[model samples]
Target: MRLKVDFHDQTETLTPEQIVLIENLLNKAAEIEGIEEGSEVSVSFVNNDEIQEINREYRNIDKPTDVISFALNEQDEDELAVIGEGIPNLLGDIIISIPKTIEQADSYGHSFERELGFLAVHGILHLLGYDHMTEEDEKIMFSRQEEILAAYGLKR
Candidate 1:
């Protein structure tokens, strides 16, 4: 899949190769999910301050999150039909807090690549209507995220 990826980082902590790795992860996910080859999605890497602002505005939360997904087809009843046909679904926009990602990665004792790949997959899963509001929901959501990451060779 073709992703119009835009990663804006104020700290410049991630290198060019890291961006390439992220791009690869996104493409692998799109392919696995059967999204169209030319489907477009945007990825934004930002500091905690920006993400906190977004969280406040969107979710009425004043805290910064690791990732947030804004999907255009959220309320579309035809989502299943659209995806089943393997059409160019405008998946959505994903915003990730870089500082949060690093913190989580360090806290989990995992490499930055693994953390980023996990977060990217998680955010896209949200765009695809996956959520963890309950124990069963968490299992399904997290399992799918891990499956996508492992499929792309991103293991923790």
Candidate 2:
């Protein structure tokens, strides 16, 4: 599959290698999810303050989250039936807080790369309609995340 990732770095915490790794991880995640070829995804890195503002404005949860995903192709069954095929889907955007990622990494006692990969995979799954709002959903989603991360050598 041809996955197009548009990366926007608003923070200086990510090195070039880290950025490349993230792109590769996103590509792999897309492949694992069976996303359509030529699909597009956007990733943005922001500070805690900026992410907190977004969380408050969009999610109404006034706290800084490690990552937030905005899926673009979400539609009801009726809308989906009317939608035409053969077009590349715009998956959505993922916004991550650099500081929060670092904090979580330290707290979880994992490398920065592993933590970042986990967050990115988590966000990508969200774009693919995976959620953790319930126990069963959380199990499926978290299992997929661990599978992808472990396959990528980002094991806990």
Candidate 3:
């Protein structure tokens, strides 16, 4: 249940509770997936401008996204394994766009907290290698997200 979180944006202000919420949600995901308890994960907050740059750089898309996850689990395990003493599993990174999250929350008729929870869970799933490039994939991904969010009482 050890996670290292880092924020990379200026405008995405979050309270300590919100930070802890993300950490809890990450641990919930790991627990449901039966991953190790001492897992390592990082969540980063970003503004639209910063996310736009990352989207273009990594995804070749020129638009800002609500959230994006870069997974370390899909790569070579030996290469990614930490050498430190009792180091947790390095899951990877979740980058969230602040302004975009606000707008999407408004657009989707949900509270800021609910939207935040959804995006955080979504990002974790991606880090766990879930994608929605197809219809069935979309169904499974969204269902799992809804299930987790509901369990956390974040469902609408």
Most TM-score-accurate candidate: 2
Selected candidate, larger TM-score, 2 vs 3: 2
Query: Model 2 lDDT vs. the true structure?
Result: 0.90
Task: Tell me the lDDT of model 3 at 150.
Answer: 78
Tens digits of per-residue lDDT for model 1, 1-156: 455566666667889998899988988887787776677777888899999999999999999999999997666665554465656667788898889998999999999889999999998888888899999999999998888888888998
Off by over 4 Å in 3: 2-9, 76-87
Largest lDDT belongs to which candidate?
Answer: 2
lDDT of each: 0.85, 0.90, 0.81
Question: Residue-wise lDDT of candidate 3 within 1-156, one digit each (tens)?
Answer: 544555454664987788778777766777777777677777888888888999999999998989989997676756654467776668888988878878988999988888888999999899888899999999999999998887777776
Quote the lDDT for 142 in model 3. 96
Error of 1 at 105 (Å): 0.7
Instruction: Sort the predicted structures by lDDT, highest score first.
Output: 2, 1, 3
For residues 48-156, what per-residue lDDT tens digits would candidate 2 score against the true structure?
Answer: 9999999999999998999999988888776743346766678899999999989999999988899999999999999998999999999999999998887777787
TM-score of each: 0.86, 0.92, 0.88
Q: Which 10-residue span in candidate 2 carries the lowest summed lDDT? A: 79-88
List pairs with backbone clashes in candidate 3: 1-37
